[model samples]
Target: MMLFAVEWQPPRLDTGDLARIAARLRGLRPLESILDDIGDVIGDQDPPAAEAPVLAERLRGDLVRLEDVAVAADDRDPRVAHLVARARALRRREAPTAAHPVTVAHLRRLVGAAEALLERLTETGTLRACA
Candidate 1:
């Protein structure tokens, strides 16, 4: 039996909100963080029976997906070697199902690498402003 002390519902995300959310993801922070914030907003509306576990799952998925992006970037652009390595490291850290000191450190590395790559692409005229 599902016994809930409080009724809950996630936030409503309009199409326009999603578009702006996507743009923020391209910023300095990791996408996992953005997912967490979104989840919190969802929880605020629906008040999840519990929030921590669900948020953790969302974050984990985001990291995994980011790792995939790193790998694909690796295959397409050998220049992204550092980012690729950091991504693989992050995947390994997250695969264990528990956080460690190294995990945080590695996450920072991945974010830095991703930011560097973004900067390089922008500087080289590969990615246009606001595009």
Candidate 2:
């Protein structure tokens, strides 16, 4: 049953590089994109209630995107450290489970937090300087 063995490693973080890149005029495009996806599920144009399974799947996927940014951020930097802390706190709430189904309201909180983080990054970041 054994094929080949593979090793696992934690993600490597290089905040300086990330900041320099994100600070580009192009901006936080990836982060903004995930926000749009989350919006479709929670946006007013959509119905108040969504199917549980679909909502859960979307919720899990959005969290994974946030995790990517969190992993790549350096905690030594105060701004990114704060965002990372907020993301970890959200994780403590945990992802959706059958025993503890989450609602759109929960997703709203996540979206709000994410938007705030993005605002902070763009506002204080090098993106401002170049413009």
Candidate 3:
């Protein structure tokens, strides 16, 4: 009888996704800073009338950046769709137009949503240790 050899191969994990996720996580710092800025604006009891427009423009710029990142991530992985939707919703929100008390509450919600999304993103990892 002739002996035959069989080879076993390990399953492959998506390392590219991990690398992209890592990059995206690093990209979150600027968004976090903008969120802090929003919080500060919300806390200001007597923000000058002129300040509202500047704050709105700044927040809009950062939220647009966030939307771009979220959309790209969602395109890569549909699992990120929910978080992406939240980013879109916040971008379209009227709260940032002015920092009224209602806007303050909305800004707080926005911050919470962003933190949750980041926390969820951090939970993503490759199935294999080497992956």
C-alpha TM-scores of all predictions: 0.32, 0.48, 0.46
Model 1, which residues run further than 4 Å from truth? 1-100
Q: Give the worst 10-residue stretch by lDDT in candidate 1.
A: 95-104
Model 1 earns a TM-score of 0.32
What's the residue-level lDDT of 113 in candidate 2? 59
Candidate 2 is scored at a TM of 0.48
Each model's backbone clash number: 2, 0, 0
In order, candidate lDDTs are 0.49, 0.56, 0.57
Tens-digit lDDT track of model 3 for 89-130: 776776554446555555556655555555445454311121
Q: What is the lDDT of residue 63 in candidate 2?
A: 55
Q: Highest TM-score among the candidates is held by which one?
A: 2
Ranked by lDDT, the better of candidates 1 and 3 is: 3
Better candidate by TM-score, 2 or 3: 2
lDDT of 1 by residue, 4-32 (tens): 85868788999999989988777545543
